[model samples]
Target: MRSSPELATSASLRYVDVWKYYSGKPVLKGVSTEFSPGRVAVLLGPNGSGKSTLMKMSIALVRPDRGYVSIGDRRVDEDPIWARKVVGYVPEDPVLYESLEIVEYLSFVSSIYGIDVPQSRVDAVIRALRLEEHLGKFIGELSHGTKKKVAIASVMLRDPPVLVLDEVFSGLDVESARVVKLWIREKASRGGVVVVSTHILPLAEAVADRVVIIHEGSIKADAPPTKLRELGEELEEVYLKLTGYSAEIEELVRALRG
Candidate 1:
């Protein structure tokens, strides 16, 4: 990821009437939304609902076929490397160099981020994620949960203004998951923009300042937790009703809200 002076002050992530297709089928159709600073937004959707695709656009991992994604003033496609510096993205499947020790890999990532994050920040991230002990271990030897923690640590180490995390709680322990929840809320409290995609409804409700339900490449509902609860008690129930699902979101909703 690279930085630019021109984009230094802008971090709001926006997708304006975006569209995407795969094999002639639409994945994200006319998706438009803006993620503002100092807020935690949770995206809830079933598999293949285009949630990941939408999150990837903010960092330029996936470009929209129509419309455009932007971070502040610069269009993501026009300057993806800079967009990356502004957004810290953690994908569902983290890409780790298995051959390297955890410490070695973090040091390499730290170098890539340059002076954007201080060594103290990096150290804090490692400590927060409880990765101190695993630093000497080969990444390949770590458990799935540990690997996930490392990936999260890598991105958080950068201390970017905008964060896009997909299935962030997958493979995490109860304590680690709690820590992540705090991370989300803390970022928003500090005036950073955060987007998190998760299948866990209760956790989602707990961390989000706003909840967005996406289905079949379109938004079914976009509102705060209060507004969502007004639709129903359980978030899954509200999601089911909004997305036209039936019976606990299984019969009417598409798939597991993963």
Candidate 2:
């Protein structure tokens, strides 16, 4: 039985024996993991470790070819729409209407999410993202970093129980990235579950409560960054060692020297 949404806040996001394939090629295979509220989870992997695929499964954007994904006691596939109602996703590069003003775009997104909050909610997000100056401008006129901020604000406006961000800090300048970090931290403090996937090890180390590394469709390591510090000189060093990227780093240096 599910605890009431107010009481539970988190529903224990879990994936069990999950598998996914693309064009006859397998991506995720027998993957199992769990995520809960009030914590930030970071997913790390090389270019093809199915990190994106796993997020897709959690958000009900893609179905697993085998196995299951569940929130607490409810199966995701059984009611994808309902499942999505509790999840908010911000993709690596969010596409917005170039013709619409930022405010208009936000209004449209909030309507789609069925958020009936007061305009103050939207105003808060705009201020938090530092989007006030650009809200009146057409999205086409905004810079890439500002566009990313707008996308993040759109996701926050819903105040969903779960947030999945894919490289969300990639294009932002240092200050904007810091703002995002604080915003996400506040959400986690409020008992929201946040999962972010990124290749930037330092940023993930800074903000994530737990780090999960995937290699070749399998979890290579999963632990708190502090816990990882005991096993390695630093989290990044252990990540590279575990993911077999240390060899690649040496080869790249050699090639560069050549």
Candidate 3:
């Protein structure tokens, strides 16, 4: 079992009976969760499970319809700018400035954060993310993995107290992914809150101080991984069971493998 380099203090990000909708269709139905600073928290779910929506609410990108989402003591909706400043968000599919070169793109983001020392900071992030080879390239010309690296590097450069990552490692190559994982650990260790959503159970199992299983826009399980899985259970099995797809999917998977 891997351990978080820093233990989170209890007062981090918390959601209370949060509800949201799209086109009059319910997305998150009374979902509530808490995340702590100085630790890594992960949300796990299948497609359309509202994991991304939850991250959006935390960063004040989208407003909740019924409940409240808070970062530390302040409510997101009530203080959007402050909330955004304190949090760093990376979406699953990132959009970059096509007209700008990679280094220039990063410089622009730093400017939004009111970050001076732009050159040194950009250089440090580029080196850390191994983006030196692609720095000269225009944003549109970069590969998907390289683009993902740039987006992630931009968020990390902000060095906010809260980090919200939606499927952050999906497009990263193995080496880059390792570097990101290490960076996440270091950031959380130094008193930042990192909330990551991924389909990769191993990644979550490896780094998360706590795991949250969201299904049908509600939490089905929330606990430490070891505590979540009893001696005879795996995390996937528990997830399958909670979602009522365990037996059916298992049979199909076995048939395919066999």
Q: What C-alpha lDDT values do all the predictions have? A: 0.85, 0.84, 0.83
Instruction: Show the lowest summed lDDT stretch of 10 residues, model 2.
Output: 1-10
Runs off by more than 4 Å, candidate 3: 1-11, 251-258
The TM-score-based order of candidates, best leading, equals 2, 3, 1
- Candidate 2, pairs of clashing residues: none
- What lDDT tens digits, residue by residue, belong to model 3 across residues 1-258? 111122225658889999998899888999877888778998999899899999989778888999999876788899988787777888888888888898788878777767664467668878878888876789999888788888898877777778898999898888888888998898889888889998888888888888898888889888888888882368877777876788899799999999
For 1-258, candidate 2 gives per-residue lDDT tens digits of 121133266577899999998899888879999988899999999888999889888768889999999887889899787777777788887889899998899879777766665687778877777888886799999998888888898777777788889889988878778888887788789888889998888899989999999998889889999998887898888988989989999999999999
- Report model 1's TM-score to 2 decimal places: 0.90
Give per-residue CA lDDT, model 1, range 179-200, as digits (tens): 8999889988877889999999
| Candidate numbers sorted by lDDT from highest down | 1, 2, 3
C-alpha RMSD by candidate, in order: 4.1, 3.1, 4.7
Q: Which residue runs does candidate 2 get wrong by more than 4 Å?
A: 1-7, 254-258
lDDT of 3 at 80: 89
Q: What is the TM-score of each candidate against the true structure?
A: 0.90, 0.91, 0.90
